[model samples]
Target chain A: MAAPILVFGHKNPDNDAISAAVGYAYLKNELAKRAGSDAVYEACRLGGLPPETEWILGENGIEAPRLIESLSEGQQVILVDHNETLQSADGLDAAEIVEIVDHHRLGGLVTAQPLRFNAKPVGSTAAIVAREFEIEGVELPRGIAALLLGAMLTDTVIMKSPTTTDFDRDIIARTAAAVGVDPVEYGMSIFKCRSNPAELPVDKLVNADAKEFELSNGNKVYIGQYETVDLQAVLGREAEIREAIKGLVADKGYQFVLFFATDILAEGSQFICEGDTDFVNRAFDIDCTGKSVWMPGVLSRKKQVAAPILAL
Target chain B: MAAPILVFGHKNPDNDAISAAVGYAYLKNELAKRAGSDAVYEACRLGGLPPETEWILGENGIEAPRLIESLSEGQQVILVDHNETLQSADGLDAAEIVEIVDHHRLGGLVTAQPLRFNAKPVGSTAAIVAREFEIEGVELPRGIAALLLGAMLTDTVIMKSPTTTDFDRDIIARTAAAVGVDPVEYGMSIFKCRSNPAELPVDKLVNADAKEFELSNGNKVYIGQYETVDLQAVLGREAEIREAIKGLVADKGYQFVLFFATDILAEGSQFICEGDTDFVNRAFDIDCTGKSVWMPGVLSRKKQVAAPILAL
Candidate 1:
């Protein structure tokens, strides 16, 4: 086998990110097989595997690509679903970085790959992987098709993400038809699953993945994002979450706190806060209505929303 | 060969719902294949398809299920991902529904074929599918692995949903690894993908597949859900979404509207409204500060938030 192709995802691979890496490796292997090229593809993760990741691996019947902290020496590597800046992928010497497929905003340092680089801010790395299948003219196997769909669903929030493109929709439509899945109900089911909130712990609900940034004034502020089908419904958890956050802030010694109640249906956000509301307002450059600040038509926090506010 | 077992999903089949139906069908076929039975499995849809569903099907190399407006007599059907509830499953019938597998709350109609029913609130139907693979001693093919992962990721909102169980987590870890996916990255990626706000239409963001009911006070109210990873960042889209809802309410002539801006990280909802602010206050039994309300520790509208408030 022409030196095993080390197909791997970024440091922390998500569902679409990891699946795309493996799926593309699978696709590339098929292509090489058709071309009579002797190449082997191995999927690997570079970081600690989470419980959810382990569950996915076991269910899929594939062994975890033995976790290696970094690329092995002499290994030909293909990076999927992340840019260099987000996580350092600079360990590879020039030729080792063969192919790069990703969906985040293109950053510097990743422009030097020699083989192939597919990057789009569309939705998921799976969309990029699906595109590769089309380019190779290979009929997707059932496994590959399902992987692609998973990638798109996760990345696009079932098409609720603004990164979703017409091309993405077209790809999804053709793919769904091929895989015998119904698009409308699939989207609705995802919404319904997200609609129920009673079973969640208050802290896990509040601190699920809150991000904190250090300010120039030596102040640290944290922002948390929650995506639910219904904001009004989550109102039920408000008291518990508020109490938890209040305790957490006191415990963590944070300067300010912000929470975003995002309405994908309304294409807006309601910013909720505690502590220096004025400082929070100045940081975000918005007027709070005491309880929440209304932001209309702001779905993309990375590009359309966060970048602008951060610039301010 | 025996006629292909026609399997259909609940109306508006979500990823977990559709993936469970197809994945289970494949497992049954594998069982039959090993058992020397000539049974084949086919997956079908009950309604118009969603965007991501197509992607899942395409990636899996399967075709989209045929729509079931009015099932003809003698059609063999297996219901997946939803119960026989007009509240959710709408028109999926029992006479044809030979097998019922789902993860939603129990609905009005009990499964006639309770022997084949696999119902549990394990968040995603994919979890149930994974369990089925375990129960039947069927090894999931790579494609099937992808389907299960897709279902789990979407249904659990990348593992942020309250319905996610240890079983769900375990299956997700295993299935992801089997497909050479990284569990941590996959979960985080799904959340990130869902966080993109620009890819979503304001209307779909606010009201896509939203549910409504009449209160005891003769007030009819509608609640829409939108989940994303970056609620604060997407707050910029609030104005457009509010306007869109206003337009939708005007067009639909809805009496009252409520939208939930669920902060997955903060574990609360920033409530927004256009019609009948009093209705929102009455529904949540709280005071409103602006066009928006900050409700903490809230996740689900149906079980945790709405049902309780509506009761009062």
Candidate 2:
């Protein structure tokens, strides 16, 4: 048999990033088996698992995906959840991307060989992965259904994120039904299982779900989001958070570092920025240079937050 | 209602290019109408229609897509068959691409907003479009079904091209059955409908379906293909074709210009080159410096010819 193809999500993996990889890998394996091809897909991640993802995997008696920092040159891989090089594995430029299943904006990635790319402007990558299962006519295992349902809820902030569309809602409803769980109740439980933001080290909270983006001026900016039920727990450490991010900006020479804490219950977020704040300030029409600004109804980092800043 | 979104294919339109755009735009319009959205999708072609495409549309009493050369800034658009900017319409950088349905390699297209992108490494974009109609549960009108089947056959060289996969064969079969025609018979009729290659003007023969590509050295190259049952007619015009493309290399500063004539019956192509031939010699291990080289089993330009050249 040939070597197994690696299937992974972006670095700094969140629930959707890691869960989508695992689900998509299983789907591909089934497809390969039915076709009688000697191909295997192994799911991997590039970072630590979030508390909610870890909880779901443990509850379902499923092992976490293997952790990998970089890829070998010419290794065949499939990227899920994200496709941009800046947000992918460390050695992505040297690796061969055979397929991609993402739900983010295109990021100027070029490839030489023709491959399968499936993306939709939906709320979660898990929703896309789940829908593919139906299209491929593969039966969804119960444990996998639960895991995917959990990521779908968290990624969409319990269906309240602005990125949620009719497609997301339909898939979420079908998957949640298959898992025998109420969508809202299950979502609340997952958010509650997250590690307490107030007790975490400032660095961990800021980098939990962050991504690197390039501005139009060719400068790199960092945007992070930490979603919790209590926003005050995160805001209480604003000074320390700012100091931690400022250190990153200085050490990494980043154009800026913006961290936002989203309160799932309140459906809003608080933004704290370090380094040059002009982009965020002008994009959102708010000055958060010295103080944190509370943005009402800002739930999704991809759609509501980073998208506007990147547009600037 | 907002402005109608324009849908188009590559600049040098082929049968698959223009036909796929027409099929996809029709599918999008149906979806919008089902959802009660006032989104209108207008199918447009970037270049003159292929003779086969014109025959199919005329046979079905369907109108040809509008011809467009450039796009206005901020105009919403959808791309089909091809995704590379170098192969797309002029002013593509300024237009907003809201969706893409293609079967080619990624080409460094960046967008500020997330959009729907569906690509597969199957034989033809028409196959993908036909599958979408099934997925959306929209009834395939007989005219459109016949139109799509024609493209699927021509693009895959009647299922003889190496790029043809199980997916393409399955969709082609289903669509042909729906249209009440034998697949091979219909395909031959479409190929026979194509205009005689020998009688074409020299420039039109050379630039009929050519596309510009950038090499690793950051230099541009142009590649064109002419497929026919008669290869002798094209081979007889080698002198005239060489003279025409050499003029292009001198006027446009291209690194090289490669043109091939594929005999569908023989399943081979004759490659002719002008300007720098190092790239071609190294890619295929053939010397066509001043003489034509016959490459056996080279039917699809994208899969058999361009892919190897670009990989280098």
Candidate 3:
């Protein structure tokens, strides 16, 4: 067989990142087989998996994606859940990106040749993968459907996220039915299965779902979100989290590292910042210097946290 | 009512450029209406319309899209057929790009917000637009179908260009059936409708359907393609074409200006390059520094010409 195309999501992967990569790789493999091509796709991850992703994979009897750090020059890849170069693989600049399935803002990526880029301004990348399976007339196996649906629910915060559009709702409802689960109940279970925030390594707690973004002025900033049912457990470790992110700022020359803990039950997030906080301060009109600020109804990091900061 | 979002193609509008914009704008308006959105979409063109596009619009009783030079700050827009800022309308950097429907390679675009980017490595953007109408369950008006079909055939060179894929072939066949015309006959009609290259101004002949691309080395280059049934006519005015393009090199500071005229009947192109020819020479293994060189079975500029040159 020919070499397998490495399909992966962004670094510091969350549930959506791993799940969308796995789902899309599966769909692409199916398509290759149907088209009588020898091409193969192998799902891979760039970082430690989120706890919820681990639970969903095990629950569905699927293997955890293999972890890879860098890519060989000319190695083909398909990016899922993210497209920005800084957020992708270490050597993505040298790799050949054959396809992209993302649900994030365009991030100044330039390609020499045309490729398949299917993106939507929807709740999650999993929804786009699921929709593609239907479009290509491929059967979405039960195990795969369950895994993708788990990501859909968590990414959209059980459909309460403002990013959840009619497309997301429609696909989520159908995929939930296919998986034979109530989306909200399933979403809660997944969130509850996450590692205890107070017990996780300080660096892990601060970096599990963080993403690096380049500001308009070309400075880099890191934003992380940790969603939980019990906000107190995460808030209690605020000093430690701030210290961990502060180390990142000092070590990596980041302009700022803003860490937030989202409470799924309360539908709010607590923001903790280290390094220059001017952008965050101006973006939300709130103070977060050396202290955590709770913003109500701010569940989406893409819409609520990163967008406004980048806008500045 | 909210301001109507302007939808436009790239500068140096080709048949596919103008047609894709019109088709996508119509589909978006239909989708907005179905969703009961107060939003409206107005088709616009960034450059002079190609003769074939103007003919098709006139034949269908459809008005040519309003020509626009630049966009106001914060003007919401949708880009079709092309994506690079260098190839788009003036002041695009200050405008908000809400969506992109294109078939070209990604061109280093960055957006603060996620968008609906529906692109494929197909024959034409028109093929993707037609596919969307079916996916959205929107009616394809006969006139609109004919317009998009004409573009599909011309862009693919009647399904002969190497860029033409199964996706393009399937969509073209179905759309041709709907338009009630033979694809080859219709494509030839459009190609013949183009202004005679020999009689046209040398500047227009060189710049029409041209685009500026950024080389990996950070310098800019211009690649122009003129598809005609009469290659001799275009080759006959080599001195004038060279003078016009050489002027662009000095005035615009382009590293090179590579002009090629494709003969639809012969399925080949005659390349007449001005300015730096090192990249082109190394890419094609041919010397066209002073004289025109004929390349057989090279119809698609995107695949046969620009891609190789850009790869360097």
Candidate 4:
């Protein structure tokens, strides 16, 4: 039999990343059982789960995937949530990535073998994994459904983020029903439970949910997003956050660092950036005369923000 | 409504590439019709269709897609049979690629937006397109079934190549039944019509069905395959073919160029290589002491040849 396949997400595991890894492994194993395949599937994580992810998994009675520092040469793996090798686990270059189910922009990941790569323009990787279950005609357990629903709601910001699609909304409703929860009530509770800006350190707040991008002009930019019900609290600590962002930018040699504080309740975001001020001003159409700027109705970093910046 | 999406395959259009472009466009249009979407799907070709592809389309009463040299900036496109920018039309970097359906190894193709990229490890892109039809519950037309079946048979060498999968076989059977033809008989006829190495000039023979790969060692190699009933006919013109290959290598600046003369009837191949003999010997485990080496039961360039060479 082939060695067990390791299914994991990128480093700094978030709610969608952790949920996608677990959900994809379950779906693969169920499909394998129907096909009578002998290969085993194990869900893993590149880093320790964030507090919100830990809470969701614990509440759903799902054990958190084991954290792995690195992989051995020729180890088979299935990546979920992210495809950039920089974002993946250490020694990923030596691993045989058999499948990738991602919802982000394509990174420069090339493989020797032609494997199954399913990337869709959806809000969350969990919605894609849940759709796979529906496509394969596999019945989802209540626990898995809850985890996937949680991921969908978190990633799409309760269907208020610009990244949210009709398909995401459809899957959220079905998965929420399967788990016996009202999506709106549950999503709000999950957001309120996780959004504790006052308690989180400036570093943790900026690095909680971040993505790095290498632009065509060879500029590396990091965008970090933090969602909360209380945006004013985050803006109150703008000076400390700016210092943290500057430190991160210098340490990581990032050309720019932009941290977005998304107000889930207000349906907008405030941006604190340490980068080329002129470029930032033109990209967002906001006059950043101060350290922070409130950009109303700019909830999605993906469609609303990243797309235009990357295109430029 | 968005502008009509131009669907096309890679340069040097083969049967699979041409057929897949047509089939995928048809499938997408059918799905859009059911959903009442205003987006029109127009099939196109990056290069002129091969003689065999032309014949097949003529037999099915399907007009050949308009040949296009390059795309304008921001023109929306759905690539079929290939995803490599190197193999794609010029200005592809500027084009807004919305979706990709392919069966080849992933090249270094990075997109700014998250699009629908469905790449599977199947023998033919036609098979993947047919599976999409099934997934979307769209019934295939008789003409489309014939075109797709012809592509599947040709790409997999009538189920003899190592790239042939069970899913490909399943699609072939269904497509054959829909087209009202015996799969074996129809496949043999297509091969017989196309496998005329003696009639083809040296350049055309090598350029007929070729794929370029960039190795891990930063070496660019071009592997070209020619299918025929008799390998001896190719061996008789070895000197001329070698000269032609050397000219191609010099003109294209390829690190290595290997041409495989595959005998469909014998189910074996003869190799004529023109670069780094030691590396070639180590790559395929064949002693190429002379210009030509006959290897038995090595029919697939993708699975048997390219995979190992690229891995090395």
Question: Candidate 3 or 4, higher DockQ?
Answer: 3
Interface RMSD of each: 24.7, 0.8, 0.7, 1.2
lDDT of 4 at B307: 82
Candidate 1 interface RMSD to the true structure: 24.7
Query: What is the Cα-based lDDT of residue A249 in candidate 4?
Result: 80
Model 4 Cα lDDT, one tens digit per residue, A116-178: 989999999999999999988999999899989999999999999888988898999989989
| Tens-digit per-residue lDDT, B1-312, candidate 2 | 769999998998998998898898899999999999999999999989888999999999989999998999999999999889999888998999999999999999998888999999999999999999999899999999999999999999999999999999999989999999999999999988887888989888888888999998899999999989889988999999999999999999999999999999999999999999999999999999999999999999988899889888
Model 1, span B1-312: residue lDDT tens: 776667766554445656777787787778778878777878766555555556656867976665656555545566676553443343444334555566543333432111234555466777877876876578888877876797787666666666667777888888998988886665555555442566677766776435555554756667776666678755778788778777756776666677777777776777777765676677677765246667776766555555564545
TM-score between predicted and true chain B, model 4 = 0.96
TM-score of chain A, cand. 1: 0.69
> For residues B225-285, could you state the per-residue lDDT of candidate 3 as single tens digits?
9999888999899999999999999999999899999988899999998898888899999
DockQ for every prediction shown: 0.01, 0.88, 0.89, 0.78
Give me the candidate number with maximum lDDT.
Answer: 2
lDDT, candidates in the order shown: 0.63, 0.93, 0.92, 0.87
Per residue, candidate 2 scores C-alpha lDDT tens digits across A190-242 of 99999998898888899999999999999999999999988888988998999
Clash number for candidate 1: 114
Off by over 4 Å in 4: A275-279, A287-290, B217-219, B276-278, B287-290
Give the CAPRI rating of model 3. Answer: high
Against the native chain B, what TM-score does each candidate's chain B reach? 0.76, 0.99, 0.98, 0.96
Candidate 1: tens digits of C-alpha lDDT, residues A86-192: 35344554335656676643333322111344555566778778876875588887656755675676557678777777768988888878767776565444445
* lDDT tens readout by residue for model 4, B170-252: 88998898889999899898888874677677888888888777777787778889888767887888999888888877888
Q: Name the lDDT value of residue B233 in candidate 3.
A: 93
